[model samples]
Target chain A: MRTLAQVVSWLALAGTLAPSLFYLAGGTTLAAVKTWMLVCTVVWFVTVPFWMDRAEKD
Target chain B: MAEAPPSSAAEPVNEYEREPVPEKARLGFKSFIGQYAGEHTAGTELMIGPLFVASGVAAFDLLAGLLVGNLLAVLSWTLLTAPIATRARLTLYFQLEKICGRKLVTLYNLANGVMFCFLAGSMVTVSATAVGVWFHFPMPGLNDFFPNSIGWVIAVLAVGVMVAIVAAYGYNIVARIANYAAPWMTIVFIAFGLVGLREFLNATQTTLNSGADLWRLCETAIWKGGTPLPGQVKFTFWHVTFFAWFCNMAMHIGMSDLSVFRYARKSWYGVATASGMFLGHYVAWVAASILYALQLLRTPGNTDVLPGPLADGAAGVAGLICVIVAGWTTANPTIYRAGLAFQAVFPRSSRYKVTLVTGLIVAVFGMFPAVAMKLLDFVALYGLILMPMGAVIFVDFFLFPKLGLTSFYAERTGGSFNVAAAIAWFATLGIATWLVQAGYTQIYFVSLPGWFIAAGLYVIVSKLHQRLAP
Candidate 1:
């Protein structure tokens, strides 16, 4: 469970980073990038707490 | 109020720096949400929002850039800073001391504490401007470096002393005041935009009959994006985005908030930063910008960004009070943080004494208008100065072990200074400073590359240093 949680945490970070890098590089139009950013943020936010709980459960 | 932890000869009554935060003392997500929202939506927003206008950022760039950048900031807090905080559960100073040794951490503490003093001082200046409104004092203009009137100095001293005394008591008072003020200040900030929108509609004689009309009005009247006023940097989309992301680099990427987040029950509770990033940075900044944009439209000649008169124009006495309280709430915690940083240096001293001294230093700095007037550049520079150390922390924490080098080498080896950490910090700073001086990039762009530089340097230097160690 801890190993899985660590992997999930790493993947969540990557998911968040991808859209941000895209935005920095001007990869898409404003609306598309904005929507993607919002989605990425939600995904990262939701996933982290679950990962944290699973990892920290003693 | 939370009482001091019990003291013993072995385990003292101090906030335990060398140990993990006990489960009993760990706070929940709501606590973090409240603190971040209150701290971020503050006097600085009033100053920063106007700076975006002064630098001539367009509506789309300013709005979109903030949305993207603030999200990045939130993620940084969540991923980079909070994970370390929860795992280590030590103050930044204590963590650094373990990794970088006592001597290096002391230097870092001095730098951090001094920067906090200047930052808190700027807030005192903000609150003093509102007081200046009441006293009918000749407030400092945009270019004015020194106090313009005796009333200005007296008001600053009074506000500074009050903020100092409160901070000396500790963050419980600061947090309480901030929680009470956050909701009300959030409303006033919203009102600032609504009232400004009404005035803009009236003055321009344009009705927001449609979404297109509102967009059109936003383009024409608000954030038109042209030549910045003389002496201000021209802001592009990248500039706005980077500034928004890096503005609090000291706290997020620089890992200063390792102390704040260390109290969290779980690392992912860092998602709570969204409250501050969105409400304070996004909403308050836009509202304050709207106030400045209105002033620009009304009197193009007066480009001086004064939050006091601007707030008074929007909501009269309520706006003035909001400005005053916003500055207070912001400065109080900052002074407290500065006190903690100073207390780390003088571990034997009580926090109250250190905090009182920290407040006085801030008050002295508050006497200088330049610090407040040039707040934008000052913030950017401040973040840059402290950021390399954050990179050092990140590298030392995660990457060192992966690279076949021990983590917390200073602690394990019982060394006084880690040469690798020092090189990573100074070398990254040197290269970044050179880049800015050589006109290759602005301060905002350099930190992103600088982080990588520091991270890489730490790894390579650590490999060499460990190999050479007897």
Candidate 2:
């Protein structure tokens, strides 16, 4: 039940944010936006292992 | 979502490489690139570009939006999907099984596999057009759902058989075909771009000019900024932007490619995806659109999007063949993935037999042209349907601890189909569907936020129900 509520809230957030990002970022700076996205991706990739806790058997 | 597999001094937890997991093998960087490029440079481009033209995206919206959107797509794969894939060492299905349980995973696998098949079938449809051009078969019309001519039917069957055979052979075969095809096919894609530029020059009867002139051409000719075809959605810069970004939402945000990237030596291997983003999605998409826009200009009556005709007009028979094979490269692995998903359903079943069966299923669906005909909506719906489980997997992997729940809780708890995951998946869908159906917003635009929604929900649900991973 808690999971369900969390999912709902996230979707709501996504709805609010994704489109807003398109607008706020000023879709006009296509190259800059691409660079920004690429940087985000690079950071995400490099650090994911550090942040994630792996699965373990009981 | 399975709790970390118990470890002793003899075995240490593998970080990014595959270790401590039986039957899981880590892959090098090149394989990851082959997989990404091969997957994204789909046969569907022939279909997608024309449809965009049909929708009448203005030149700037289509051009500028794709430039921005595709980069976002590439980033999503690099950032959101790759890191987990390199770290997890499991297929999205297997990892989810650990989190959501076998029953829930089975449902997701079915959806994932089916979506892959439909996607493959469209490629088959694209390839068949080349056969129609080469072999003199009567091609199906855009509105033609069923195989209109005996020749078209034969061509599709022949293409389908080849695709199925290759798919059944396994990943080595799939990767090899993609690798072999990528280089040559990429050249052909570039040629398509150059030819489009040449044709545009001829049409405008003007020498190449400064940026403003090109922008004007985009507004006037390329995007032409028109309403969509009879049943298609209107694509403004926003629609084009999101569509370009989310076209591969299932693979990136949905985490389906976790199966393919688990082999990477480092997550940064994902940067190679730019090869496909630029080569196939960016260059090819724009080039193909130029070709189609040219077609609409030359003969306004020809609404048919068969690549053969478009390619023939752009660069003779060679372009036609490129369109066909481009579809094959993309579709081949997609069918293979679907087969793998189906394989999970009957664990004892051989992948070869499952792929063969799944290929036949898609081919049969191909018989009705509608599957390929309405590809835009099909792809969006495809991503939407499969995405929730992907979200469940991501959250189960990354966010569970933050929620004070054990990751991979299902495997640890000995549950089949984690109840919290199962409920979260459906509940997110139900609500998202409600928003779309009630006209709150469009479906194509939903995936980005929808992904976060499902991910957050999975964790919260895991906490509320105390469902224990099982």
Candidate 3:
């Protein structure tokens, strides 16, 4: 369960860095950044809620 | 019948005041995503980007440094702040209440609120410049820290009033404004980069345009890594990295954002900060630097920092609006947070009224030109001032038990003021000051090591204080 939590945290973290990464070489356009921001926003929005506890669940 | 009980009359109660932040307002994860992104991608980009150019950081450093530094900052929050916040679900105010006691917290709140006011005031001043461009009022120069004219005073008042009103209304209002302003502000920021490039090509009268040319343009026209501007220190990758990471040191690593992030559905919601880090810090800062670089190219003799004029040169009216609104969006949340800090100290006072009062204080300072004009120095100073408090909190959260002293010792001992917290706070300052006076490091360099020094000192002092006190 702790590992699962860590993995989810990592994925969410990936979501945050997505905007910056989009600025990297392969997709080096501002449009690419927006697309990645939107995509990551959607993915994280869906994935994060599942992990948020009603109280504290470790 | 009228007599009080003897036992009740004889005893005095003094446990650390623990105002566990009530989870009354349940905001979704999306709210936090927007809040962090919007807060981080603030209006200060107009100033910061240009400063980077002035600092003369190398291209490798400017680009790679921000990437690494920002990543380190995000990880610091997720790994350090979020876990503790979720576990305790307390505001820094509530947590500090236990450590600092009621009287000392009043002092801390004054310091915290005042620092925030100055910060918000600077943002207000930043946007006011854009308004000056629109109105054609006289603006401040690099050397002028004091308000130069009646025009400057009025412009800041007008801008401060509008921003404070919106913030005073509530958090939802601030969120809405950020939501609307962020996308548009980002568009204009990018346009700044594109339009400035066209002008650079026009002025130089060159034809070859490839990725190398683009990179070359950034190096020569934008960053132009060189000697420090007259009073400024040379910024390299290390400088830029640390600045980017610690710029909001109090908020994340210092755990000021506990109040903001407590509403998050999941602590992982911290991932949302990327939007601001990349969009505002990485992209927008570079774009504004390009604009500043273009300005330097045109008026090589001029050392003035007029974001309004620089933006005007690049994208005309849109740049002006972006600067003005950029300041407002950033300042709104800041003033709100400052007010909350003050309210925590006073407990009985209405937060709205105190924040409005705080807004007025910021506005009065906003009338001064120096704080905004000499931003780099003020930023460093502000970070240094707040860093000690952050260090004490970090230690109390993580290291107290390991030292064999009780965490929240003030609460346990019924001591209104923890002498140890007081020692750590001032000792760190004394050392940082001595270091500066001793000619060891620039003001900007003191914050990181200062944070650790504070945390360590607090542990040692708190242990000793507890042992020595009966």
Candidate 4:
């Protein structure tokens, strides 16, 4: 479960970054990039907490 | 309210304040990398990056200056700070107490705590600007000193109170949140730069087929070198370099990061700071500068450097969240540290009550926008004031033995204050202040000479002090 959480978290991170690159490359609108980033942000917060702090418990 | 020893079998020890970090507790190099990357890429980067643009820095000056200055900063951490930290493995406060004595350390703590309050207050101001974006309140401009409207005042008050309350109550939770937000916030900052760059290119109809074309766009549209805006100084290459290098002088030269690095398994792990210097100071700062430049390009009249609207314009809600979270996370630890400083001074006070009061004081400081507006000068002054003590510590640690003088004089003599350390600290401050006031040197350049002055004074005064004693 933790590994799955970690993978999902990494995807969320990538999701946050991809839209900006797409917009910069002239492949997407600024509006679309902003919306995509906002969604990725939500996913990041939801999934990251499951694994990021596990070291403390270990 | 007595603090537990680090070696106590109890759960969750109080960070080994008085004793050396145990070998088992030492952290790996990766820890420092993540820690620096997060800590350095803070909300203040938003203010600082924009201020560089306000100072009318040219393209090469801003770029090359940051590159060189950040390299020097990383080296300072590796060579100057980390080596001492790994060997001593003691907190800055404890190390100073040994050398300067309790009374002098109290004075130092007072100075440190007050500076932390103002620094934290500026973070509150940064966060308040995000609130302004959402609420459409009139935020302070780059040159505005006071709260401009009732709405602005109320917004600052509301944001400050929320931050202070959380800092006083749930600091650990906020720290965790900050850690989680670091990677996301770092990406948002990159997005800000990219989006700003694209907008600038589109608005100016510039095509970047070559490196030269990109350079031309940066020179012409982004950081056009000319007269500074009203109430700002014109920056040269040296100014950018010195400002970048000395901006965190309190941590590296002033030895405040001894506490953090003391837990490192190896001193060379200081190289991990390059992640922060390059990623945050270089990338985030340049990105923030691009955003501000775009603001100027679109509306030639708007000179306000509010991070909230700026971020909102770039990446929308994500940008606003970045501004708020960045400010809140950085300010939380600052407020907590200030509280600890204050609590150390008045040992009988409850930590909760002291932190509550400290947070409220920081909130009051936040209400005035001057500190945030003129952060460049404020940061320089902060580093200048605290840097003299770093010289004293350096001299005592390295040169005292060679010079036939005892190290940690106060600790050796069982005294509450060492007059030699006091003389060195005060005299250097006085000289540095005079140089700045008399226009002999700007605040950015004063610390270099001031360090030498403090080191020399410490050696001379210690000779007389030890000779005269007994």
Lowest summed lDDT window (length 10), candidate 3 chain B: B1-10
Off by over 4 Å in 2: A1-58, B1-31, B169-175, B467-470
Tell me the lDDT of model 3 at B461. Answer: 81
Query: Which candidate model has the greater lDDT, 2 or 3?
Result: 3
Best by DockQ: 4
Question: Candidate 1, residues B1-470: lDDT per residue as tens digits?
Answer: 00000010111124766787888878888778866766677786788888789889899988999999889889999999999999988877778888899888887888878888888888888888888778888888777789888988898999999889987875565554455455556656776676677668767888666889988888788999999987788988888888888888888899977877888889999899888788878888888898899999999988877789888776666677778888887788778777877887899999999999899889889988888877877787778878988988998888877777888888999987989888998898899999999999988789999989988898899899999999
What residue pairs are clashing in model 1?
Answer: none
> For residues B1-470, what per-residue lDDT tens digits would candidate 2 score against the true structure?
00000011111112432232333545556655654555556667767778788777887788788889888877887887888977876766667777878787788878777777777788788878777776776777767777788887778888888778876775454454444444445545555555565566567774556878767766776668766666667889888788877777777777866765666677887687676676767777777777788877777887778776776655454456567667766666667767867887888998789988888877766656776777777777777887787788777777777767788877887888677788777887887898899998888887767777787777777787784422
Native RMSD of candidate 3 (Å): 10.7
| RMSD of each predicted structure | 11.8, 14.1, 10.7, 3.8
TM-score for all models, in order of appearance: 0.84, 0.80, 0.81, 0.97
**Error in Å for residue B340 of model 1:** 2.2
Docking class of 3: incorrect
Model number with the top TM-score: 4
Give per-residue CA lDDT, model 4, range B136-200, as digits (tens). 97888888888898888888778778877887898878888978997898899999999999999
Off by over 4 Å in 1: A1-58, B1-14, B348-350
Give chain A TM for each model in order.
0.54, 0.46, 0.57, 0.91
**Of 2 and 4, which scores higher on TM-score?**
4
- For model 4 chain B, the run of ten residues with the poorest summed lDDT: B1-10
Lowest summed lDDT across 10 adjacent residues in model 2 chain A is found at A49-58
